[model samples]
Target: MKDWNEKCAVVGIYNAYNASILSYYSLFSMQHRGQEASGISSSNGEKISTYKNSGLVTKVFDENTLKKLQGNSSIGHNRYSTAGEDSIDDCQPIFAKYSLGELAIVHNGNLTNAKKVRKNLIEDGAIFQSHLDTENLIHLIAKSHKHQLVDRITDAINQIEGAYALIFLSRTKMFAVRDKYGLRPLSLGKITNPDGSVGYIVASETCAFDLIGAEYVRDVEPGEMLVFEGAYSKHITMPKSIKIFAANPKPCIFEYVYFARPDSKVFGRNVYEIRKKMGIELAKEHKIKADMVIPVPDSGVAAAIGYSRESGIPFELGIIRNHYVGRTFIEPTQSARELKVKLKLNPIAEIIEGKEIIIIDDSIVRGTTSKQIIKILRQAGAKKIHLFISSPPTISPCYYGVDTPDKSQLICANHSIEEVRDFIGADSLAFLSLQGLKNSIQNAGEEKFCQACFDENYIEDLQE
Candidate 1:
């Protein structure tokens, strides 16, 4: 199946005992954001130390390993390659030693202007350690002649453009910043110990806070920088001169649709509720006759329930997904996709036999997985298959962090609705209208969202 992978997950903790262990728990909860590499860096009030490797969090760190990263302040990352080649050297939080001091950074979004910035930096005789965009950020911070650490970070970010939720750790303090557009999600959390001491957490999602018994604070504002010293944290505003996009903040709508866990609260709305509303809206937009409403499993479950409720169709587990499908599967191809469908999901012959099925899915990126799944259902005796996508058709490739297929490769970008239906071998196919999608997220707070994938409305300035 063609899966949509986000760039990474980041966690920062300040004034916490066993900061590395708490950071480990936070990263474990957000392992879904990235799977290629994981790392953590800690500051013990005297020196900054780091431990990182290319693997899952569980595989990268153990009990003794966390103990070695002793400190009351730490930052961590889980990475999926977007800006650079996947290798041990590219793993984060990338650490550096400079004239100012020791610093470590964990970043969660792609900088649209990184290449231009890197080129200019190289022209000035700056050396780069890795191809990762985060490495470029480290370089930017190092070059800034600003005396204060926060001022240097401010200077670095002023020159770059794109979506980012960044966490920076120094020998004495911790810092976090979200891009002006807020295209990615980041939240602040608080954990109170029995002894009345308070600890702070910053992560890519609130689910990370839930696992560690931390209380969810509010989201880090777009264009806002947060500084943490011990248990005290303060907010700093980005310079108004650097603001380039429309003044309105635009978050990534794909987070609610697919990337975030259903249990998460993103952009100030519950993801599960928003997805359910999306499914309901999709059903209202397209009324179809079907014997059962079945989901693609996991991602489609909440939306499928809403669809079944709205249409009065029976909801059944027509397809069972294998939870043990690992990253070591064979490379994806036409034949491999077919084989993968068989290995990943099995049709419940008793429920699907002779019944027309309406399969609800979040979105179809390439249409290969849906096509193969329909084939499997047909082979199991499904009389007919109709596909309903909860979100609008994805027609543009995302450049602000998501690892998506190029525009030329996106099925919806290249084909019409009927063409996609035919290619997927479905009896009929319908996608949620753009307006319906907008209505579904009415409760997602005052900020607008980046719907570039649905409509070619790039929100950021991508030109060099």
Candidate 2:
């Protein structure tokens, strides 16, 4: 598997007086999905107000910004660049004006056919405002038959290929749709406001529901369209009723492995539990003798715990992460990224000294970060270092919303496990098997799950 970095999350809400507060909370819960940028849009019955910037959620929006956004309905986004550069225009809740009225859209997942769609739209006199694939969706809707908003949305979605879970906001209504394959995750929930009016919330993961005290509703059915009016909700069935593609059902496995917050319940499986099980499985497969199991801060904590429990190794927080670090990947230069990683993570020599440490991380996309971490540990006097990845190798690039590199850029896709281990300077390296990864999520039910990024089997028909 290779190390590819692409990810984002979206949250939408309706009928809440403090819509900005709820939006902030939801985005805060999904902060792990993306650290590069955060944006939010709120509708105050008359107009829509938005606030977005190139930074983490808290950094982008503050009390002053929230106070300025007066609206009863809102949509928010957290982004990690899968496509397009990190810039202000690329920030989400993209707005546009058309005959149907104004719309603000925030989307999760990528469209494999985005380039083709954009080309076609451009030929038809549509001017693109940004490089994001999401902009194509808005134009598609504008050009479609405008008999009804949902009908237009359905037609636009039918032309899109790859993973997507989108929340569309119109002047009077808020709607959400998930791709037929369910390549990404989307869920719906409801909350009660002080005035006794009910509020509707939609988010990429269940963790967002916890922040605003919204109850967990069922996941948005793959290929399902959900419409939330002021006080009512409606479900639109898929035009073509289908579940798993017989050829392949590849949901981005990374969502379960690294991208989602540990507290999230994705595909009905608790992310923390699944990650821990991956660690346990990795330990079982590798059987390495180590003095202590240490995690790479937040994302690896669960898996490290699992590895410790399964391997009977003591767990220690030998590496501390500074939560305040900004986006290192967007540091503008290689040296900047290296320096940022060092500033963000520091190995506690007192805890790691003389210890044979097993470091658990969700995945290794490029091997650069892993190499740096291992170097830090060795420099801190760790006798030996072992690396355990929770998910199987990401051999294939993701066409879905995730931001994986092209085939030429994926280091693991071109290298063997031993090669990757040697490259990272780890004494040993092991990844969870595909079957074991599936087994970890078996509690979620027998319905199929997408493992395309691990398997290279795209379930959606490219031709369609």
Candidate 3:
């Protein structure tokens, strides 16, 4: 419900008997990453077939379509369009015929150099079909003079910059690659078939592996590529790793704060544990007096629990979210806007009436949603609302994959904390300190993460 949107999810299955089925299930598991479109492309050793549409995974693919995509290797994607127009033509698993035979590609992050490369490609007489920056890759691979697919991929990799977790599927092999900075996430896993044969899977999140019964191996390292090749039909060995670029890992910190599923392990840590720790850190940072601790439903639940545990305050689900509030309508009027939020969340007067409550949420974007939430609690007869966020106030725009508005639109970027507190109608408002966020991570190694959204430090150029 907040403004930040995940860019996409990519899953690749190799040497599995039901590669298409496994891909479908993995995409379904990671559907939280993207909802605008879903697609899969399968390769049966000699040929590659692709199917894509603009909708949720379940709505886009069915038994009939899955049966038609018969193959032993496949790659799939769920897209939220950070770099493309919202159209069927922009749906992913972009398949094409090229000099290196045929291949399909799925990508999970935005490319910073796409416009320059696309313009160069266009000047060289390349005709474009889709608005997706991912299409820029297809052209790069197709036009490369390298004799082999891997070499062509390396050539293309050299031409692109910024965040990307990409999966490339050919007529016989599959390749998974992560950018030098690891701005987005992608994990590698192993799947043991019923016949004792081994297959491979790589996905945007480890949660995708859980649904398909794949064993979690480890994260694909930054600037690394895994090349998968073997005979068709559920028989494959471990992938060949190639170090393409020197590692400079700066994985997005927002994955722990919002994008990832709580149960999944991202960047060598469990998201749920980190979130609970964030709540604990929040309790330590903010000294509050309240009757109860409450969550804003869904994303705020875990941190609220941690806050309650740390502060010895009772926790309550004061706000209930409608799980089936699927399709959204345009709200042109003020009344309609309130109705839209009310349709998703309504307060429980029995628990909240005349009670001083501490409400926890992930982050505030434009401040309108937070204002509406506080308004609803006021109407429910709550005595006071103390609003807290688990992460540092988002002050800058994200240039990697996360969908955020410009600095002018981010409320915290423009307004003071006191001003924001008054705007949202909260008695008090506080955000977790940047150090608190670092403490929640529980990092034991030298693992550094991208906090560009919290602190403006762009490793790449931000174009005008």
- TM-score leader: 3
Task: In angstroms, give how far residue 92 of model 1 lies from its true place.
Answer: 0.7
By lDDT, who's the top model here? 3
Q: What does the lDDT read for residue 34 in candidate 3?
A: 92
The sequence of per-residue lDDT tens digits that candidate 3 reaches over residues 68-126 is: 89888999999987877888999999989997799899999888888999999999999
What TM-score should be assigned to candidate 2?
0.90
In model 3, the runs with Cα more than 4 Å from the true position are 233-235, 444-446, 461-464
Tens-digit per-residue lDDT, 21-80, candidate 2: 899999999887787889988887667788889888988988999999887789999988
Candidate 1 per-residue lDDT over residues 13-75, each given as its tens digit: 888778899999999999989999999999987889999999899999999899899988899
RMSD in Å for all candidates: 3.0, 3.7, 1.3
Error of 2 at 23 (Å): 1.1
> lDDT for each of the candidates?
0.87, 0.81, 0.92
Return whichever of 2 and 3 wins on TM-score.
Answer: 3
Worst 10 residues of 2 by lDDT: 232-241
Error of 3 at 207 (Å): 0.7
> If candidate 1 were superposed on the true structure by all CA atoms, what would the RMSD be?
3.0
TM-score of each: 0.95, 0.90, 0.98
- In model 3, what lDDT does residue 135 have? 92
- The lDDT, on a scale of 0 to 1, for candidate 1 is 0.87
TM-score for candidate 3:
0.98
The C-alpha local distance difference test score for the whole of candidate 3 amounts to 0.92
